[model samples]
Target: MAKPQKRYVCQACGSVATRWQGQCADCGEWNTLVEEAGATVTPFQAKHNLQGGGRTFQLVGLDAEIALPERMGSGIAELDRALGGGFVEGSATLIGGDPGIGKSTLLLQAAARMALAGASVAYVSGEEAADQVRLRARRLGLGNAPVQLAAATSTRDILTTLGQGTPPALLVIDSIQTMHSDLIEGAPGTVSQVRASAQELIRFAKERGTAVVLVGHVTKDGSIAGPRVLEHMVDTVLSFEGERSHQYRILRAIKNRFGGTDEIGVFAMETSGLSEVANPSALFLTHRDEGMTGATVFPALEGTRPVLVEVQALVVRLASGATPRRAVVGWDSGRLAMILAVLEARCGLSFSTCEVYLNIAGGYRVQDPAADLAVASALVSALAERAVPADAIVFGEIALSGEVRPVAHAALRLKEAAKLGFARALAPVATAGEGGMTIDSFKTLGSLTDHLLMR
Candidate 1:
């Protein structure tokens, strides 16, 4: 039988090696190579000829008229919004998160809502038994939802059962890592196994016109576990993220062929299940009676949604010859260092002898570059021991040359801040005033520094 040729594969990059090695040559990752059996091919198949045998398919023009795929909501407004209105028929979505981060709970809740809304939904759990899922449903108050449930891990059996009768409108596989395909020569979650299993499931989803949601386990670095191609095979990639200590969970779309990326859906984990947070800005902002040093409000934009969050900082003088510490949470550490350097070089403010601490309120992470101005404001306020205006918000991009740059969606940010009762804004010079709020525009970091120190 040709004794099935053997080869080594890198789990990190899916690269093949002729022999096992301690480090992967392609990805440079250590101890990721594992041996696997290579498929034996006949002489004729090894020739790599593409001549004649496959069915011919017609190629259509880009402008050809075709009906758009229908979208069905899961009765969850936040989820629908993050999914670019709703889940498209025949689409495949991959969602990944840390363990205990509520990936299964969110999917089960969505499935229940869809079933209650009259959509045929089937949930297959490879990690848990059917009764365990049922118990969870009961806990979530969805015991009466008409969603079909099963506990299976064999891909062939799942396809066989799903192929019978009418195909369900929505299908959820509670983790793709646990699914095994008979055709694959390795255990489930292996590089080849994951690739092959996902391929079959995605093909079924497209052929059956069912929206399939696949749960994925994440690695220590917070990326989906499996070959990188698994993410590319799906129509959308969602990331469920939150700190275990925090009650808020963020559902972010990292890749979406049918929708905009970077869109986020906010949810609060309660005893009943996940509840949507329509006004996430309010939840992220900590209400305080008075403004304090090192605290600044920043209007951050998440996709099309504007969120107002507090930027807090602390600066303490370090002992002589002691290494200054720079700690940051919910904001980029490198960016904070760059901002501090700019403050010293451009604004003549020295932080070389100070230990700095920065944090974003409510365990929320900020990625927007417009947060530069706010973070700088907080740092300056901390060093100067002066509180920024209690009702004022700050946002803008700070360049290395200390130039205050304008950011996108300025109007949306201003309106949201105004709606949140922020009476004044310290922003870039180009930002337009809105919502009857007073504007304090700055043209450079030096000007902002002067305002903070001089005030």
Candidate 2:
């Protein structure tokens, strides 16, 4: 018998190497390579011919008519929205989040709702036992749902049992890291084991026309803990994001084969269970008796939804000989620095002798460029110790040259702001207004700076 070949594989990126190396050449991660035994191949197997040994199938053209995959609702509107309407049959989805971030709770609630809707659903837990799941269900008041529960880690056993009966319409794997495959040699959570286990489960889902939802753990850097290919192999990738100190959770789809990317679903975690937040804007806006310096209201767009959030900034004069400090939360520090540079260079503002702090209210993150004008307004207001108009909202992209640029969905954002009782908006020059709200348009940052400072 030929000796089994040995190889090294990077646990982080799944790059294989013939010899052991300290660093992975593919991803540049150090000390992640582990030695593993490769499959043995005989001389006869190596010389086997494949020219005429297998069956052939006809290929169809792009115009071939095919039925669209059916979608099954989980009875949770927020979850369904995040999943692009609903879960598609024969699809595999991977959800990643930090521990205690309600990944299991959300899924359990969804599974129970689906079961209540008269669909057969099975939930397999690799981290928790069936009794623990039952207790959790009781706590969430979903103990009476007809959802099947099992606590198993062996992929072979799970597949064997599912193969014997009618395939469930939905199958949820509590976590993919703890699952082990008998065909693979490595232990559970290893790169090979994770890849192989996910492959088998995905294959079963496609062949049996069942929807599979796989729970994944995130690394300290907030990325899914597995090979990069693990993300590519799934049909949909959803990220559960929220600050542990906050009660709101955001379900965002980063990649989807059957739906549009960047779509978000909002949920509020409560004692009963995760409740859907129909109006997310109201959750992020704080009612203030009076407008204060360094505070500006910004209408931000999260995917297709327009949300109103407050942007705050503080500028404190540093003592002589002290280095100025800059800190930011819920926004990019680099972008903040860039905006500061523009203020100093284009608007003739002095910030080098002061410490600046920026924050987005309600612990919500803002990625839209339309926030640039609002952020700049807050910073300048802080520096001048003057408050922006309490009933006015600001939104527009600021170019490096200090010009205010137009953003998409201007009408949608203004409508959302108007519905929240804002009487005026400071936006790009071309933005149109509705609902009798006063529109103040600025072509350049200098005009906005002059208006705020000269007031």
Candidate 3:
């Protein structure tokens, strides 16, 4: 009788080995070693496809294929811009966000737009029935776009349908978590199944010239919940981020093979559907009651687009020994901490006994250091309970030495501020020479201290 073959398997990473150990060196998981039948792909085996001889990695790029035509327009100007002009053929895109965060809504809009552009589109959803999707489509006011919908959960069935139908201009998978494959032995969302399903779909996208968008689920940490490979496998990855309580949603590109990764798309969820906020700054500041203390308008850039945003801050003295709390809703917490440290060390400002809360109005995340001036201004306003000028605009990076440091694209930021009817802008002194528009230059945080105190 043939002897049963045995091999060591690392449960953490699925790497196979002949020797066993207390820990899996392949994946660094402690005591994840178990003996099983050998299960691993040799480097030679992986270089080719499963069916036998296919294009090897080394065989590719012998002579790069001529670049394809320019991106196909998505019809929504803002989304087109966010996608760096449009969809690249055969690119796999993963869009992830919180539940009820407009993931399906956005894709439905895109599918209809593509269909209106005279391109065929197929939308697959496992969670929603076709009738429900069609009902939402009617609500979007999509005028006679020849878009098709399918309620499918099986990856194979979707692939088969795609193969049988006319090649679609785009394919929309409502989500990846719901997809299951018969080739994998695990549950739908298990690491193995997700990986296998994603790989198969990725292959399908690349083999066909369809722009496929996969909606994904986000974990509590705000990361897409799946094997890390799910992220690496896609050509582009975007996240739909916002508070569900608010109507505004921000689509940010985390990965883009054909475009800049820093691109962001702003939209508003209205009674109709997701509508692009063309002048997002105006929308972000529309609800302002005017002359409010602890409020600031800040000029910033997202990818190549410039925007002005309202920043609000609140500071209050603590009644107990809980220590000063600093929290930000739409900006980086680490960034706020860094600014606070700068304030304490450079300007000798002590809010150790106070509570500080910062918010970027409109549920938008601000990445521009230009907001430094706004944050500082807001901090002062909150502490003193004084209102910042309604027309005041602020942007600058603060150094530990209290110096206002220069930032990139001063011209763009200034142009945006000027276009927005902003009266005065406090920016870094160094970049004051770059932008043609008028702006106040401040070098030190201490210099602005009196201005805050006086206000």
**TM-score of each model, paired residue for residue:** 0.88, 0.87, 0.81
lDDT of candidate 1 over 95-174, digit per residue (tens)? 99999999999999999999999999999999999999999999999999999999999999999999999999999998
- Lowest lDDT block of 10, candidate 2: 284-293
Task: Find the 10 residues in a row with the least total lDDT in model 3.
Answer: 430-439
Q: lDDT scores for all predictions?
A: 0.94, 0.93, 0.82
What lDDT is obtained when candidate 1 is compared to the true structure?
A: 0.94
* Alpha-carbon lDDT of model 2: 0.93
Highest lDDT scorer: 1
- What C-alpha RMSD separates each model from the true structure? 12.2, 12.0, 10.2
C-alpha lDDT of residue 399 in model 3: 78
Q: After the best TM-score superposition of candidate 1, give how far the Cα of residue 164 lies from its true spot, in angstroms.
A: 0.7
TM accuracy, model 1: 0.88
Report the Cα lDDT for candidate 3. Answer: 0.82
lDDT of 3 by residue, 185-251 (tens): 9888788888888898889888877788888888999999999989999988898888888888888
